[model samples]
Target: MELLNQIKENAKKANKKIVLPEGTEERTLKATEILLKEGIAQIILLGNPETVKANAASLGVCIDGATIVDPATDSNRDAYADIMVEIRKKKGLTKEKALDMLNDPLCFGPIMIKAGHADGEVAGAINATGDVLRPAFQFVKTLPGMSVVSGAFLMFLKDKTFGHEGVMVFSDCAVMPETNDKQLAEIAVATAKTAKAIVGMDPKVAMLSFSTKGSAKHDVVDKVANATKIAQEMAPEFKIDGELQLDAAIVEEVAALKAPESPVAGKANVLIFPSLEAGNIGYKLVQRLAGAQAVGPVLQGMAAPINDLSRGCSVSDIVNLVAITATQAAG
Candidate 1:
């Protein structure tokens, strides 16, 4: 909570404008109220204006400061549709199809970002991950030199017992089922940047596996090792080491016996898992068992600051994500 407060403070300074596509949902509506009251960011809500107003009124929430756009009736609908046609023309999208797609807020929200109508977008509280991400991939796309978009969680533990005083990053937990060495390297680089920008840490990245510094021999070990090398080559100034087991990466005593020569060993704040299965399982274990606050599966490598929320997220989660998105936009 302390770390989140610091992030919120930083976000407040950014004063970014964030669009919420799931505006009609109760959690989103409630979160918007806090965002407005706190002056966290300029808020835009996408939905039918009448429905949104009615819902907020009944829920005793005030959206006086928010801009509500009814995509169905907004005058910009045609203009946005035209923009989509131009952007997606190479993929065989026609004006008719673009107009149809614009009817959905999922598509419309990202289109708004690409068209410069908003700084960033947040959605998926009531939508699937694909519904939120597919449009972003088509509209916002990836940043320069990035091959794929990945997801990471900023794990904030209560005790400073491990990994950069209890704040660590776990990557590829929500996207990319499988990644090659190059993709893994990209994930490391991107995760490091996220750690610095969002978590306010100088990142020490660990490419994690079941082996420690070539102590075990396997193709999977080699993949992680190669990825570490590529990541180091990509960011020569960043501190990174790899092919380490979880213990060697975060446990000081074990690191001394296993990877004594590695700078990132036992002090790593950013962990890059070799596979999605491992990453997902690892984060959930820490989140559930360790009682750590897992904020995100925040989408990284996008050209803009668009994010996806878990469908089961709470109002607080929505609020925190807005702050994180705002900070990203600021950067």
Candidate 2:
């Protein structure tokens, strides 16, 4: 499906409030406008209200100050502390700890979502991944069935190279540095489910490695093989395979010659890497060296949508990620 069409679908389903941590950037401000104007959901923008409005006005974007949440305001502090305390009760966080979070406005967004004030959050437009994720782990935590929070990058392309006319997802590139077979399997399942929700299709997942089946040998190769098996067993309704090289995973001719019997040999829409080193370097190669628009490093497996924007992101980067996060939340 087209990117804008996907965004429209997400906007249609969003009914809960969404929070933006750093709402001062041009792209984020514009995204806020898109959300409000589309009537997607109620948006709570973090930062000073005057500063946010000033930034939006300078960017030729008009944002209503009343709709934006200012954590710095005295009126919000007491409520913020109370919300934090309530949400962090499971973590044994004390009143003092909750009060301390009120000092930093960054903590307010995720905390608000955790406290039921908002349904989801979109952050990291101007912050580091660590900063964007800290609050999520502190409050939002993980979904009931998920143990570790993982991430995936959406590769939107219009090239003949992938031999397809659609976008796809590649995962574990930004989250888990190293994963066991179980974790790899879980990543594949989560990524596939995400694909189904956003793309409206059953994802064909390829657990990518340097080897094609048993053509090569290494502990890592075995991990991919085992992960593939686990994923197949866990998600019997989904098509998946592993121990396949990138070429065999995506190239029709190569896949036909390599693993002709595998259902996902050539038509995989999602790729799961066994290690963070491979996932990170591989996606960067595709994005920077191969000319694909890498829309993520988008965080997955969380109960709510909280994405980490690259620190060097541009205004457009912020816009796309906000849209991606909204899609995640809505779906």
Q: In candidate 1, list every pair of residues with a backbone clash.
A: none
Q: lDDT of each model, Cα atoms only?
A: 0.91, 0.78
- Model 1: weakest 10-residue lDDT segment is 156-165
Model 2, 27-67: lDDT tens digits are 78887776667666567777787898889888888666326
Model 1: lDDT equals 0.91
The ten-residue window of minimal lDDT in model 2 covers 157-166
Model 2: per-residue Cα lDDT at residue 216: 93
What lDDT does model 2 reach?
Answer: 0.78
Report how far off residue 299 is in candidate 1 (Å). 0.8
User: After superposition on all CA atoms, how large is the RMSD of candidate 2?
Assistant: 2.4
**Which candidate's TM-score is highest?**
1
